[model samples]
Target: MINSVSIVPDFFQRVKTISFPEVIRVFYDEEPRRSKIHCPFHEEKTPSFHIYENGFFCFSCGEKGDSIDFIVKLYNLRPINAAKLIAERFGLPVSNGPLSRQDMLRLARAKAERLREKRLKEAFDNWARLAGQQVRILAEAIRLQLEEKGLDIEEDLLPLVHELPRLEWWANILAEGTGEEKLELFRNKDFRRWFTCKN
Candidate 1:
């Protein structure tokens, strides 16, 4: 069996050394060092989320925690499971218990689930980044297409097309949308075509 007393302190020490904001950024986009982003814990038009060196606090929703707490909240995992994930991610050694067939299968399933979530998060990030870039490119293309057709478009509206609302919309979709919804988004033929094209 694992020695909890000896291993817990070492596990926490290693976890504490990891930068809290850096870990937040891996799962959500945040500006470096005290910049505000939309609170992942609550829905709002304005940003009330703040990340400090030691921890994070959401002003709107009153959510506050350190790195381990953040992982528990983000992943909806129990404390022990979160600890296991952190230990695995950081390559910290955990004292092994005797494995039965069921235990081995459960461990394998958990690892696979984590891997699937990682891949989905990566794909979501990639889609969001490309969508942001495409907004600018598509706007320019539309302006050109309109010009070619001799259509009059307002000058002020041109800048608005590439502004914060577009980005925020995409962020909301990624942050709040279900997995099936995200998959459906990527399945759009136009999006797939654009995603494959060279920039």
Candidate 2:
């Protein structure tokens, strides 16, 4: 479940304690004290962004915000992530609220799911690249056969021919500890027929 409040007040308070000018100095070449720098949010030839002791304001875009807001906008981070980044950078404590066992489990499950999805995507991409190479070889063979028969090769046939190996490869990769459904799909007679089709 999502947190009730994405931005924890304590975390924001800690982030606010860090000087905005100090954070700006990390990214900008010029000193931040009343100095003008190009607005990080928008493109401009002149430096219209001014840094104050408390926060920053861009004269060109009318963008004004505090330290946490600056980090969030500059890095394109979520409120919690930005707060955590600020805390980590400034050596401040991260947790603003107590975590229940359910929250811990939920976080763990979410992390595991993300990792699994990433691995599955990588596997699919790798199989796709190999399948594309195989399809090119098949297309060349088909072209040679058509030329021998004094016939024209159809462009649409390439995709139909390629689908079989791609689906088989995808199914095989997904079958590894995924479930019986993928294996069953791979073993279906229609799928097998498609895999073995010459035309």
> Relative to the true structure, how large is the alpha-carbon lDDT of every model?
0.64, 0.63
Q: Give one digit per residue, the lDDT tens place, for model 2 in 1-199.
A: 5464664776687678877776675544553323667888899988899888788889999999987788889888887888787666554556656666765665567557656756875675454445434545654565565566543447665564456455545545443323334345446686556444221
Query: Residue 141 error for model 2, in Å?
Result: 85
TM-score of each: 0.44, 0.43
What is the lDDT, from 0 to 100, of the residue 56 in candidate 1?
82
Look at candidate 1 and give me any clashing residue pairs.
none
Worst 10 residues of 2 by lDDT: 174-183
Q: Please report how far candidate 1 places residue 128 from its true position, in Å.
A: 18
lDDT of 1 by residue, 1-199 (tens): 5667776666676666767765675556554424567877778888887788878888899998887888899889986667677656644444444556765666577668767767877777676556656755655565565566543556665564444354345445545555455466567674465445222
Model 1 is weakest, by summed lDDT over 10 consecutive residues, at: 190-199
RMSD of each: 8.4, 14.8
Candidate 1 residue runs with Cα over 4 Å from true position: 29-34, 95-199
